[model samples]
Target: MENYKIPGHLRLETRRWAKKILEEYTLESHHFRMLVKTCEAWDRSEQAREALAADGLTVVDRYGTPKAHPCVGIERDSRTAFFRGLRELALDVDAPEVPRPPRTRDYGSRR
Candidate 1:
């Protein structure tokens, strides 16, 4: 089995997530690169979210008009990138077993 190290610079949560994914999956070299990019995007989204939480969601411009905080867009774009990477990884298809249905589903009835 090939050994891959998680990048040191990732945020705590992102590092944990990356570690878990690495442990759960056997990724090719290209897939490892994608995972690193995805982790970076996750960290970027988290950083933007933190900034948005510290600052208000909207900021006033020089004209005194309130506009969405720049971090809002950063967070949005980063989240999009992260999800796209996940789709490309196709982790769900590689899982060892099929996932159970959500508890909200009515397993007792046929619809």
Candidate 2:
């Protein structure tokens, strides 16, 4: 929808993606909100990744011990959020199959 404007705060790539999705899908108001949240998550993930790349994946703690960068977790969590939002928006290409529990033998039940 031309009337729906992508948020200016979003990164250029994120903006383009959001625009394409908006044009391609017939989304309700709630879906639009989800789209925005998804885009924000994508942007946040990208930002964290960039920071990680520049700073390296580890950082020295106060005790002089190397630990995982905070951005590492941020990137991971944001990526998860983005994907979850995509699923919520029904924009993912393939629907994830629900896992079914395996059947167990009833050894305790006497015939």
Candidate 3:
């Protein structure tokens, strides 16, 4: 099996996504779904860098102090090497398996 190497920035982005919706933010399901889809499209680590560049954002994957695009203008008193640590941790978490709903079986007996 091939080793899946996720880019640090992508892991940071995943953290950003989690922060945006997890708990405090409480992002709506629709918005979360969209984010999930977007993440799926840019699943590769290298893709994270490209995606950020395409969006005019510069991200440095530091262990504790991941930086977003400069345009965001967010200040920080402290920094860590872990880029989006929460998100990176979340990536390993198991997602709930959603089983497909049963298909409608037409019963002619009612007719």
Candidate 4:
């Protein structure tokens, strides 16, 4: 029930946990749309800023556009915002953990 807030930077700690949280909470149509818009804006802003500032050695395509990097998805500003949004709006639930096998020691060893 708070005002629309976007984080200044990505929260690295929340990256993995974000997916779990999102899976638990289902947002209403209105809120979901707003979050999508915010994420899209952030994705554009980050890509544009970094692409313009890159060195000549930076890779590009035949069209001269910046080459897609795998880290981009992990490092995007939108990803951070989305994670933060997930933490704020999603419900928290403890996963049902499975039991681990017990360790056993052999008392009798072959002589």
Consecutive 10-residue window with the lowest summed lDDT within model 4: 12-21
Better of 1 and 2 by lDDT: 1
Candidate 4, residue 36: lDDT: 50
| Model 1 Cα lDDT, one tens digit per residue, 1-111 | 579888899988888988899898889989999999999999999999999999989999999999999999999999999999998898987554867567666676867
**Candidate 4 lDDT tens digits, 44-107:** 5556557545633246778998775544543466557756764544345444386545656753
Candidate 1 has an lDDT of 0.91
Q: Which stretches of candidate 2 lie over 4 Å from their true place?
A: 92-111
Report every candidate's CA lDDT. 0.91, 0.89, 0.45, 0.50
What TM value does model 1 have? 0.80
Pick by lDDT: 3 or 4, better one: 4
Judging by lDDT against the true structure, name the best candidate. Answer: 1
- In candidate 2, the residue pairs with backbone N, CA or C atoms under 3 Å apart (3 or more residues apart, or in different chains) clash, namely none
User: Ten consecutive residues with minimal summed lDDT in candidate 1?
Assistant: 94-103
User: Lowest-lDDT window of 10 residues in candidate 3?
Assistant: 74-83
Steric collisions counted per model: 0, 0, 9, 0
Q: After superposition, how far is residue 59 of candidate 2 from its true place, in Å?
A: 0.4
- Candidates ranked by TM-score, best first? 2, 1, 4, 3
